[model samples]
Structure formats: C-alpha cells, structure tokens
Target: MGALAVVAALAVAECSGGSTGASPSAPAPSPSTASATCPSSLAPANPPAPAGAAAGAAPQVKLVVPVDTSTSTVLKPDPAQQLQCGKVQVDTKSDVAFAAPKLANGQAKQLLMDIQVPQTPGPKPLVVYVPGGGFVQDDKQGNLPLRTYAADAGFVVASIQYRVQPDGATYADSIADVKSAIRYLRAHASDYQIDPGKVGVWGDSAGGYLVAMVGVTNGDKQYDLGENLDQSSDVQAVVDKFGASDLSKLESDYDAASQQAAAGLMTVVGKYVNGPASTQPASATPATVAAANPITHIKPTDPPFVIFHGSADTLISPSQTLMLQNALKAAGVQSTRYVVEGAGHGDLSFTGDTKSALQWTSANVAAPLLDFLNQSLKG
Candidate 1:
C-alpha cells in the first residue's frame, strides 16, 4: 500500500480491531502484557513548584496547536491503532478546541486537541503529548495514538500540533507555541477534569525535543506568562522517546545522510543555520550534550522522568537515554529507561509494515511506558 493507503489502513484498524495486515518490516511498537514500574515523584508537604510559585496553584499555559483535518479525523483515534488486548474504559472524548499562539500572520491556526478525561474525577493528573514530524509534518486532527494509550493507562491525556517552521517561519515560533499550549492547558484544566498540579509532558522524536525544552525552561518568565494565580504550568513528570536532546551532539552525529536529510528538512522546518562558523568555541560541547541535555535541569525538585529508545536507532542514539538515566541517578532524581533492540528514531508501530518493530517496542518500550505514566499520573 502507498503512504496514504497505509495511513488509511491504520486508521481503519485503529477504529476496528487488531492490525495483522501486511508484514511490513518497520512494525509498530509491539503490545505486551507486562507493564513497567514508575518511580513515585510525589512530595509530602507540597509537590515541588518553580521558584516562588504560589502554593497549590496548577501550572497553566495557552493552547498553541494547529490542526489540519483534511486527511485526519476530528481529533479521534485511528481505529486500526487501538489496543487490541487492553480494553480499559478509555472514556475518550473530543471537540476540545483552542487557539494557538499567534503566528507572524497576526493570528494562530486553530487547534483541535483530543482529550481523554478519566471517569473518576477529583482533579486527575494531566499529560500532554506532542507528535513529532521534524516540527513541520504530521497532523493532530485525529486521536493521537500515544495520547489514547496514555489515557487508557490513566492520566488525562492530550495530543497537540504546533505551528510548523514553514520555509519562512522561525524555530523560535515553534518553541513559543509549546509554551502557549502549556499555558492553555493549565488555565483550563478544570474544564477537562484534570489536576492542574499533576500535569506531565511527554512526546516522541521532535516532539520529544519539544518536551525537553518545556522541562528545562519551565520557570522562564518569558514563557510562564499564564493567568494561573495559584501555580505555574510546571510539569510533574516527563517522558521522551528518541528526541533530539542536544543540538550540538545531534550535529556531531549528522552524517552525510543525516546532513542531506537535514538540509532538505531545514528548509521545511525553517532552520536557517546561517552565518560563518564562530571563531571561539561554544560554551557548551557536543559531549556535554548529556550534561547540557534536559537531564542537566533534572533535580530532586524537578519532576520524575522515564525515557525509552531503540538500542540500535541511527537517527537518535540509544546512548542518549543512558546519559539521561545516569544524570537522573547522580542527581538523586527518579527515572527509568528501556531500549528496543533494533528500532529507529521514534517509529512506534507494531503492525503492517513495521509489525515486528512495533512488537519489539511494545514488548520492550511502550508497555513500560504505560507503567511509568501510571505511577506518575495516578496519585
């Protein structure tokens, strides 16, 4: 099947039942019965907040998503991708629309977010998901496959799409959109029956990088401009799947193939790496990618994190997770990791083409992911 056909097929399977279709090589993350254990990140007195954040206030942010439903659903899950084994009452819902941060056009694109609120309420935890496509591709109109998975496992789940770094747009704008979405979620948690304080952020690939940015810079005054008087939209937990954690380190791994792909991708994402090479060395080095990585920002005060990756991923090395795990351990923070044997980037599939890959990841990564999210989100 063609790309479009594959998507349609996946959609059908998501809406219907199991996807034991074509035996494509690149399978989705496999589903497994065994779950993972999420280390608790709760505090006795009060969950740690940013500097001087008001007590008992939930972190909030503006909804900064852009939706294109032409080929995608109305922010619902693709039938083909639904879990076949686990039939937990997801209690999923839709029509949770909001406006993203304004673009250079003096207006932001309309965002259609898929929200899954728990049946049992009383300020439930929240987990926002960002889909990855190098910041320019992918749609958010359909049910975010990962969000539904997270929701089924527990937390109030959300999947968002940020404005792309078009040929003329800047990367900074994409970053701004993330902050906007956080603010939006924080301000409107009650509407979705979520615990404003227990918000956690997670994403895959480029989405993973976006979540990292959100984690490292949560307290930045520029991005923390929310109306929440009680708390900031600071997340209590994070999960990154093979995202670019450090730019310089990423650049080091930039081979001819990657540079070629990046050259083509840069224009689409609007990354104009212009100007002459600086004469002086940057304050940060590629090796410190780990130190300068989101793991650097990790502390006992920061939210717990769990990262998963394929052991043999070429796009983003598995070693990245090792670095993150080590950092969290050294800092006395809570964390865990799982690596699939032969996955690449963040392809979380287990049927059709990548059925094997999917199966492996499910057995190794996604299942663990559910447990990790459960521990953090279910208080």
Candidate 2:
C-alpha cells in the first residue's frame, strides 16, 4: 500500500479494533494510559517473516510509522510538564579576554573574564561579578558557587579579573578595568546573547567597593577608558557584599579591636588608592582616597543598590555598608541593606560551596539579590 493508504488503514484498524488480538469487549484505556502508549501503539500487529525464516516461523519487523499530530487532541494537560519547573542549562566560557590594560610596569596585560551563559531561548540580562581580595589580590574564580547560582538563575554572569595592588596597579586602573568589562559585554552583547540594556554588577569586599563605585559613577567619563567607548558602563543594579565605602572612615566605624585587627587591610586599601586608608604612607593621597569612596559620587540618579553585610564581619565593618546605605538614601537613591546575622566577612553563608551552604545563600542572599535585579533590570 502507499504511505498515505497504509496510515489510513492503520487508523481504521485502530478505530475498529480489527485483527490485533485485542478483544472487542475490552475496556478502553484511560487518557493518561492512552497518551503514554501512543508511541508504541503504531506498531504493526502482524509482520512479514524474515527473508530466510522457515515457512511456519513468525518474524519481527520494526516499522517506522508516521503520525499526523496536527489534529491530535490532548485529553488532559500533564501537570509535570509545566513551565514553572523549567530550568535553563548554563554554559561557561573561561578566560575570555575583554581588554588589554597596561600594568604599572608599562607592560600591557590581557584582562580576562569567565562568563556563564544560560542556554535559554532569549537574550538574558548580564551580571558582571568582581571578586574580593583586599584590593591586593583579584580572586576572579574564588566564588564559583555563587557565580554558578546566578547563572543557573538565568543571568549571564561574567566573573572578571581586574588589576590589583600587587600588579603595581592603581585604583583607577582597577575601576577602569571593571568599566571596560561592562563596556566589552555591551559591545559584544549579540555574540554572548546578552541584553545590553539590562546590566548589573555584584562584588565582594574590595570588589564590592568597585561595583559600588560603578553604580554611583554611572555616567562619569573618567573611568570609561580603553576599547568599546561607544558602549556605556552603566549598571541598572548593584550588589555590594561587605565592601568598603569610605576607606578613611572605616577605622572610625570599627571598634578599637577591629581597627587593630583590620589594620593590614587598611594598609592594602591605601596602597590601592596610592595614599592613605586608615594608615599613613600606604600609597594614596588624600584626594585619591576621597575620590575612591563610592559615597563621594552618589547622586539621586544612580542605579538602585542592594548591599549585603554580615553583622559579625570585622574586616570591612558592617558599619561601612551602613554608611553607604545611609548615604544612598540621603541622596534620594534606592538602597536596600541586608545584614546577615552572625555571618563574618566573605562567609560561607554568602558564597556557598556545598548544597546546604547554597541553600542558606539562596534563602538569605541570592533570593533577595535576584528579586532586586529582576525589579531593577527586567522591569
């Protein structure tokens, strides 16, 4: 028979229950059962014997049946097959060079970033993550769990590498590197399937401070240097995790013990800006120190911010974040601060390497961060 004629015959056989060994009086299968059996239901009831088979022998024939599904009706919708439970698979691209920044030694270095893109259908919002390392070290891959979590949640996360104090790099170089990364993402948004219009930045500790600077100095041109100048480094949302706002006032915010404990960190900060943090002769000048503070750049038109700090943090001082939050509010900006109780600086509760740890972060940090980003960017 022709293909169409065969299919029609199968359909007639199916409707009439003809010669398939199924009793005519047999009860029809339930909707779920029918749907489940639809795949195998098209198998021919009788098959031709193999070419060398004995006359009396029955042989198996695997038939490829074509079914017209356009007119098929789904008797019942499967609750298991719902969009709410759908998850986007995440793909990671590592060590992608975004910029070539000149180091203090005058040697140009390729600044790289590790990006995580979701395999979802549409262009996803972009989130540039800067890792914290006391401004002396840039641990770009330090918090993979958090970065992966953000990626799984549908954001294109680029964990970036910036110049550090050890590279003889100044604060401007680091800030410029960050802004350049943002601009690079925007410039290549189509290549990475990123929604250039919706971009956000998240950082921890010194990195947090950098993101805050990026947030506050939205349209300031000083930091917008090196390639992709056409693209804006403006971020719609900022997440600051235990980052310093005002380096000069950090010591004052801390208690005597904390000041003594974080003295070395203050020295690193001073080195970053090239003058003084809470110590003398570190590297930074008074003007440089003032300019590095995110609070110094805060305006009413800056992006919305969500600052996370641990009450038990002694390194950056939760009060520093509080100072930032208060400054943002005073400037008529939208800022939300969440204090993770009993959690220390860069705590596992915020970074999450294990399942339980991720759960804790999802509940305390990621959930709120996602909510804030969705509202600020997706809206």
Model number with the top lDDT: 2
Tell me how many clashing residue pairs each candidate has: 42, 5
RMSD of each: 16.1, 26.1
Candidate 2: which pairs clash? 274-283, 274-284, 275-283, 275-284, 275-285
lDDT of each: 0.50, 0.65
Candidate 1's error at 270, in angstroms? 7.3
lDDT string for model 2 (1-379, tens) is 1111221222233223222111223333221201011112111122221121122211221122221122211122122221121155667776677777766556676676878887878899999999775565565656665666677677888988887765666678888999999999999999788999999999988899999999998999999999999999998999998898877665555445444544444555565667212346333466777788888899999999988775555455666787788889899998888775544555332222122122224333456777787888778
What TM-score does prediction 1 earn?
Answer: 0.64
- Among these predictions, the greatest TM-score belongs to 2
